[model samples]
Target: MKLITLLPILLCLFTVAAKAQDNNGSNPQEKKVLKLINALPEIIASNKLRMKKDPQRLLKAYIEFTPTAKDKYYQVSVCDDFADRLFAYYRFKVNAATYAIFYDDFENGKLVPLKVWQKHAYGIYSKR
Candidate 1:
């Protein structure tokens, strides 16, 4: 009888866990990546930079910019190099499947991290 009662409880817990996973991808890392990718282009534009209609691959960039003429915190994601246009905006010399996030407020314009964005995106990532 105890096993019968425990079975239902286990199933319920499993269902809740599955739903959570559905809401957030099997790997939270991927979700974080998408969130970052979705906000790249606008950030670039807001910085007084112009970008082509597309990126090297797939990106849905956004930004949190001010109307005044001053640079602020920004985050960007570069999905791929399919269109060969990601670097056209930042004027950065990055390859593909990488992120070229720049922080105008960090270290007097020194591009930190240099790389390693894929392994530890969260370390440098910040959501709106």
Candidate 2:
């Protein structure tokens, strides 16, 4: 009788655990952020500087959450770390929901859309 009662309890516990595991992958926004983060390195590499005169192995990259009241996104940054000093090569924001990208145009004090930024990137990268 005790074994019979314990069997149902064990089965219930197992079902709850299985459902918890299933719920972990159900968040769509998390999946998008993970996918974009994985691909950012390759995207940055495509536009990297290739001057023979410049030093090699000086660039490092990071992806961070950009805190906001309503809008949410990830910030991808590639920086030059030389002699313990850091200089940002570029910073971009990718929307958490739509995956739209915006470049941080600090000089102009605005966020530039990826399409427009690409036009500027073409000239910067074409010479190399």
Candidate whose TM-score is highest? 2
Note the residue pairs that clash in candidate 1: 38-60, 38-61, 39-61, 39-62, 40-61, 56-81, 56-82, 56-83
lDDT of 2 at 107: 62
Residue 125's lDDT within candidate 2 is 26
lDDT of 2 at 104: 66
RMSD of each predicted structure = 14.9, 13.0
1-128: candidate 1 lDDT, tens digit per residue: 99999999999987784332121223444455445544454444443322454443333332222123343223333333345333322312221234344333232454444343324443344334
TM-score of each: 0.22, 0.48
Q: Per-residue lDDT for 73 in model 2?
A: 65
Model 1 segments more than 4 A misplaced: 1-26, 41-57, 60-79, 83-109, 112-128
What is the alpha-carbon RMSD of candidate 1 to the true structure?
A: 14.9
**What is the Cα-based lDDT of residue 18 in candidate 2?**
34
Candidate 1's C-alpha lDDT?
A: 0.38
